[model samples]
Target: MKKQNSLFARKPAKSPKSKASMDYPETLEIIGLSHEARGIAKHNGKTIFVTGALTGETVRYEISKKHRRFDEAECVEVITPSPNRVEPFCQYYGQCGGCDLQHLEHSEQIKAKESLVLDQLQRLGKFNPESTTPPLSGSDQEYRRSCRIGINQLMRDGTPIIGFRRRGSSKLLQVDNCPILINPINKILGKLKAVLSEADSCKEITHAELSMGDQQGAMTLRIKKPLPESLSSSLQKLAEDNEFRLYFDNGQQINAFGDEADLSYQLEKSETQIGFKPGDFIQVNASVNTQMINRAMDWLDLKDNDRVLDLFSGVGNFSLPLATKAGSVIGVEGVEDMVQRAQNNAKQAGLNNCEFYRADLSKDLKALPWYKQGFSKILIDPPRTGALEVIKQLEQHQCDQILYVSCNPSALARDGAELIRQGYKASKFCVMDMFPHTSHVESLVLFEK
Candidate 1:
């Protein structure tokens, strides 16, 4: 048996003796990385989250609280630098907490994410995708427009705060301006915060989901509870006051339309026009999504007669595009609205061979009417959970080729194991830095039977 390394052994936490000790953090070297922002430094082999430390960074953190095995606090001083460190671009970068990795360079972020995929493929899946396909990639900034931001109704001191969660915590980060976001949505965020600060009916409010369409934005309000009719009037007034369309969702939805705007996207030197809603799950980095899709298509190596099945396909994102080249395409989605929107998008695109079906893809795929279609090509773009059931079904079906786009690698690895076990092989994959300055990594893998 391999001996446990002393670096991973937990160090005995010292008592909080002096107040000065709390303010002046003990400088420590960061060795290994914790799953999150916390890094690991060990006296023995026992592990703890080196508060305020990034992987390879050496820093000191004021230990606010300590236990037998771990210590926690905000990062205080940088004793030494990590090779991966970069100056943050956003002025309010660290304070905003919208992105955790603003301190790393773009290329480093991609490499880190790719490394994660390689780790998962080797360790969890017990296979390698070191050479299968070219990596998927996208832009780093302004890629996120659809997000559910939280708002603190009133601070303990009666002040108000609204925005994303704090770094390494569930507490909300208070800020009026978020520089990492797209300008238009950031404007809405500022205005909305200002408006909520004064609204009489809105004593406390949760965050809102803002999505950008090709030309307009779709906004949804996720209130804490059922609001009064007068409150609805207030929301409308707020919208008119700011010149932006806003929708309210008090456990239910009240849809509203915005003035039509045209949006154009580039794909393989071709610019495709799109009309979208602010609340729809448009890829955060639109330009990067185009590149990612292009790479996926290249990896697919499609044929004119190939029949493609797109799982977790949102609004014909991949399905419709495949239809442009393939014989027929089927898109499966859990949301009826998204499914219908995909159909509309296909019609608008003048693609007749694509079809969209509404089904709970997270559940069993066998229940879906289209499960047994036996498609020649398959693509999955699931949420953070990745595609477990869908992967299982694919293994059972044994499609000729599959392209899986994922945001979470752990889940991807879990499913990848099934694919390898069932005769499918992960040939190649790359991590795209869709989000920079944060821990999130987007991945793409091509598996073949």
Candidate 2:
């Protein structure tokens, strides 16, 4: 067994006499940002990481978590604020973990994200992209079309909190409205709180997912216990009054109501619309997502003879669009439901050239039928873990070009190194503001042999 190091052990709380010996409310000058977007500083020869601090700013912060070589602190006052600093519009900005960069100017946030991606690529992959494309951007506020709000214990005043988790904690922070959510979704939070807090099913619901399309909104409740019929009827009425769809999921079954309209969004470039269930994995920022797909098509420079493969394809977000130019497109997803949904979406879009398949992409796919097929272009949009196994076989499949839509820079870098080893050179790279005011960075890269 490995022994715990003493240097990193927690220090006991100080007694009255030794309270003066403690280091807190310490003044520090931030020099950089950590991967989590926290400000980095050095004080007393030991590194200190400060939350809510920006680069080149001096802040007064108190230690929140102690460590061996570094300590974590929360900014109490910004004695010297950066010129890029701006007032956060969200009332719960500091407490909510959903939006970390809300205090920074939106333009500055883009610059920081570009730097972060470049740093990760150089440090982890040891290579620079041939060229950097201008970032794809969109509205900074009220852009989130989908969000999952936590339902946890009520406050001392007996009001339940329905919002995001607090920073670095499991506690839920009650929010009346979120500035980042679309207006339609934000408008429903108050009524949702009122109905949910007073319902007998209040404690039974673990969380609620809110999603909105261009024309309609939907909410899904993940309930641990069966809701009373009366309460379910009330929720249905609430959905009808607000012109939204509602669904409830107990441990065993799901019930839905007021689903007159297909919860869907249109891809203007392809003239295709995609329908998704409440729990499907649709991109939260619709405006940026459309731009991203358009950018992906441009970067791929698709030819009519092209045969493309879309890996980790979710509900045909990219497949149907790629089919617009490619001769044939194959979309592979891990989840069976998503595979079915993708096929349905492609069929609805009148895209006969596209097909969907369910496969576990994390494992070897050398013998798979799709693996045997030759692809002129490939698009991968894996989760944070990335598509290492799939990239490892790209050379064997004789793929000519590869485009990656990355949500995690580190994972992209790791997989990029593998692609480089397979004789692929990154030709273009660009960042996307898919998630504004958050540390999350979305990037796109194009590679060719």
Best by lDDT: 2
How big is the positional error of residue 393 in model 2, measured in Å on the Cα after superposition? 1.5
Clashes per model (N, Cα, C within 3 A): 24, 0
Task: Enumerate residue pairs that collide in model 2.
Answer: none
Candidate 2, residues 1-449, lDDT tens digits: the string is 22112111223233233213665434779999987889999866888887888898887666666779887777766778888887788887777778889888999999999999999999999878999989989999989988988987565655677888876678888888999888888877777788776664377878888888878878788988777887777877777777688888775655685455368899875569898877789999888899999989988988989999999999999999899989999999998888998989888889999989999998888788877888899999999989898888787765789999999999999999999888899999999999989999999999888
Query: Any runs in candidate 1 off by more than 4 Å, and if so which?
Result: 1-27, 62-74, 132-139, 155-159, 224-243, 257-279, 362-369
The positional error of residue 313 in candidate 1, measured at the CA in angstroms, is 1.0
lDDT of each: 0.68, 0.83
lDDT tens per residue, model 1, 71-110: 5544556667777666776666655556666666777666
List residue ranges in candidate 2 displaced over 4 A: 1-25, 153-158, 258-261
